[model samples]
Target: MSRSTYVQRTIRNTIVSEKSFKETLDSFLYELRFFHPVHADKMIEQAMEAKDPKVFDTLAEEASGRFGYLSFGDHKVHRYLNKFNPNRPVLESHAIALGTSPRAYSMTKHNQEATINFPLRITVTQRPNDDRASVTWDLPSSQIPNLHLNKTLANAAFFVDDKFEELIRFCSGTMDEKKYKKILSMDKGAKVGAWKDAGGPTLSKL
Candidate 1:
């Protein structure tokens, strides 16, 4: 075949392939809707007309937030929502600080039993698609905790939001090491002579 003819045929084949792929995706989405109902409805509608992967991602992200609140039974995502716009209203809360990386929680091996106090291993990863902390715990199906994991996740989100200001203040020259140490010692320590008076008897006993 001529060069022009070959190029034309290649373009035609590519178009046909894309059309076939789109058709298959449409059918799969049709079947998926039965299983997921609301999510599938939202995803399928977005997928069918979406020209970019970002659109589907947006739908998935929104659905994840909604499901997190509905299925998890609380507005966990709402607590830290202001972090995205820190200039806005501040929500004071506390959470485990894991630095720039999302917070993680896992069971550590201790005395031949699973220990929740200290994590055995920690690796940083991208933030979650939603406000839930990126923590993972060894929650066995047979031995699930009486408390919901989502509640803990929500608490973690709260901590991240609450401490952000303190962290920023420290970063932006609001709190330095010397001042912080002084504040800590002054707030927690006794007066100049309070310990000395008690120490008179304690020192004699020693």
Candidate 2:
């Protein structure tokens, strides 16, 4: 694509994204009390502090043609509705910080053990005309007991971006299974405490 064309597309996307974000934000804030009181402050901070709210085309579900909220931010929890953040380096650093990549939760390895400590939610909707995927990360929940927002973003980014990138690469018939399995088996660190022990991936960086 030409530079002019790319710029035009970007400008158009921004216009659409900003409008959708405002619509979603008002709805999210209105229902904040049901989710948690903490989000009231967080939502306001998110709206004002981040001048350009991040855009995540991945989590932005579409209907007919235009993207809009279907239910509960339309599969986007809070900031992630259209927020494309936790870029590549931040995703990697946060994964290391949390010590838990999304790969850590292998059902076969655990013999189907069910737990909710580190949740990496994944929803795949096959697109007949698309081959690419988008990625982003958000805090686990504003109400989780001890883990703060930054730590949660780090942990979630693994699943959202880093690990999903690998999954996409592998499924695209580019990567060999042997290499992918090796990547999966390696332990990075424990998710909850790695933040306490050795923390450096800052929120600004994320």
Clashing pairs in 1: 94-159, 95-159
RMSD of each: 28.4, 19.9
Question: How close is every model to the real structure, measured as TM-score?
Answer: 0.18, 0.20
Write out the backbone clash pairs for model 2: 54-83, 54-84, 55-84, 56-82, 56-84
Q: Give model 2's clash tally.
A: 5
Could you give candidate 1's per-residue lDDT for residues 1-206 as a string of tens digits?
54321111111100011122223223222212213334424555766687665565455434431111101111223357566766775432222211111111111111112233221111111132322112222112112232134344334333322332332222223345675345335422221111111111121110
Off by over 4 Å in 1: 1-149, 176-206
Prediction 1 TM-score vs. true = 0.18
